[model samples]
Target: MRVDDFCDYDNSFPDEFYACLPRECPDCGAPMEMSEALTQLHCSNPKCPSKVVQRMVAMAADLGVKDLGEARATKLVSEFGLDNPLLLFSYEPDKDGVPEGMSFDVANGIVSQLNAKRRMTLAEYVKLAHLPFIQTSSQALFGGYDTLDEAYAALEEGGLGYVCRKLDISADSDVSVRAARVYETLKMFKSDLYQCIDFVEIIKMHSAEMVHLTAVCSDEVGFPFKTKADFYATVNNLYQNLHVEFLGALTRNCDYLVWAGADGSPARLTNKVKKARAYNEKYEEHKASGTLKEGEHEIKIVSAKQFLYILEQLVK
Candidate 1:
């Protein structure tokens, strides 16, 4: 007989099976709440030991620290009485005793790995924080800010109402409720969980897609363009197929400096222009001294006409 034929026609299972399952979380003894769909049971306690261990393992992986699997995380938590995953960053080999099964060297290696990842992008920090209902899509809420301080200041000043306004979400919408939860969770985490590590740097995230080259246009008017917006539209339209990205500022990664102003003219010597030229000079000096690393290239300074010509040839 086929297995399907042997099974009951109805999907219902025996009531005994449901009774066999525990109604409470095994580790934390918290009541387990059944989902609305009745497909899964969720422990209501956020501080449940099992959940904490899982979070510890996940946070370690997300932070790029290797070898911090579930078993190791459990051992660390039990040994150190760790209440929060972020506390792992504070573990000191000199001050703390090694876990029963782990050697001092292994523990030290884990600390070293964690320390090496002190510099993280803002997006990475947000993901690691694991704020409630906040995912990658929420990153757009932080657009236009180049530093965490600026973003945090705005959030503090405006609160969840600010986030809803920025996201164009109605206050009574389901998404607004989620945004409120995320805001409250972020505030809670910032005070305790986020203070666990002394960060070396928190780089601002860029929302643009990756491109082979990035160019910055001078705001000063010059040939073939009357305004900055006109320059942007013309060049960007012509070079859309050239894998080149444009930005308003001359960051370190910029590959081209497009300026239509006359050479050495006051209008041409803006801070961006001067910075790009200085960078090129430093890059050349490094190249001549045999200290330049591979893949390092100087920013090419070009006028609008020259840039358009270069892009035209490149597309061909």
Candidate 2:
């Protein structure tokens, strides 16, 4: 009953499930898209230098902004003792490595600063996008402002600055880095959810192993199992004895109900139906006794696929 024995295992990579940038940029008020070549970064700006600077400043502010509104001048002056801010701007256009008229040291230093902060806030990101290098499209990378309104609203509300200020406070004192950790934790949560869905889909492909399929609606939910047509086809074809029931009484009575399978067999389908009826009765009794909350209870409904996994794991 090992997972591999019953299920044909597929090693779908994690990147397949991860979220990507939305269709537009959130800065400089332009559309953002990938290039067909995928070798270089493309920007909404037709002018190349502004695109370059936008990209670099985005990179620079990857973690957070060290200094807002100030050009890389102060950092360069303090660290490298550059007498003239213009001295840092020399570059060669033809060279693919570092573009002409851009400060590599400054870019590198900004990158370091960003990494040190370990997170980026929306305000810092906007500030970075508005840098002189980005505006001029110098030797830097480009940034896009796809959702201009939403991004701008976040900036105006000071949410972005609050996040950065909190991070700065954490660096200075014993404050928790919760603001910084929020982004990383959400990403991990999404990764885990993807993995769970992948497991459920893999269980469905095993037609012989599927015993019972039931649909108990809490809300009309759709899943990524190919398409609506494909999902219905898989369920109907694999589990021909599929049962569809409306929890008319239970939905009106309880917050949630457990959709339990009986003896791990679709042939014993009457038992599951009976169990569902009894569950509603017991739930009502508990509700009358004031043990269950009127509006807050978790209902556990089983998918035919999920039930199969549960049965397999129990047998092992």
The model with the greatest TM-score is 1
Please give, for residues 206-313, the per-residue lDDT of candidate 1 as tens digits: 435312357887776367665554454344334323344457689768878887653443464778888888888889999999888676788888877777777777
lDDT of each: 0.66, 0.35
TM-score for candidate 1: 0.55
TM-score against native, each model: 0.55, 0.20
Q: Give the total clashing residue pairs for model 1.
A: 0
For model 2, residues 1-316, the per-residue Cα lDDT tens digits are: 2222212232443544223433344434455445434333344443233443343434333323333223443333334433222222232223423323346664655444433332222222333233332222211111122222443343346542444453344444434344434333323233322222221111221235434322443222233332222233233323232312223344433322223232242323433355456666766778888887555333344544564454455444
**Which residue window of length 10 is worst by lDDT in model 1?**
1-10
Model 2: lDDT of residue 205: 19
**Global Cα lDDT for candidate 2:** 0.35
- lDDT of residue 158 for candidate 1: 90
Give the deviation of candidate 1 from the true structure as CA RMSD. 17.1
Please list the residue runs of candidate 2 whose C-alpha ends up more than 4 Å from where it truly belongs after superposition.
1-148, 160-285, 290-292, 297-300, 304-316
